[model samples]
Target: MKDTVVEVKSLDQEWARLILEAKKIGLTKEEIRAFLVSTKEL
Candidate 1:
């Protein structure tokens, strides 16, 4: 899939912060992928 950047409003910073916190606690890439797959709003 061709990946591209799209402009979004303020929420990106919050997402980045959450991801950084998750990394500090050792959330695996696979786990994150599974969570996103199971999450409808994602």
Candidate 2:
């Protein structure tokens, strides 16, 4: 999981953008969240 204190100042906007992009790419919320988590680990 990502550190909670990393600061999500633009998280809402970021998430909104991600959701829109995901929709275009046919990605579901679960897939998006998993991808985020996996990327964070890297």
Predicted structure with the largest TM-score when compared to the true one: 1
Q: For candidate 2, which ten residues in a row score worst on lDDT?
A: 3-12
lDDT by residue (tens digit), candidate 1, 1-42: 999776675567776777777778999978766766777675
Clashes of each: 0, 0
Error of 1 at 18 (Å): 0.3
Candidate 2 residue runs with Cα over 4 Å from true position: 1-16
For candidate 2, what is the lDDT? 0.82
Per-candidate TM equals: 0.54, 0.49
RMSD of each: 7.9, 5.9
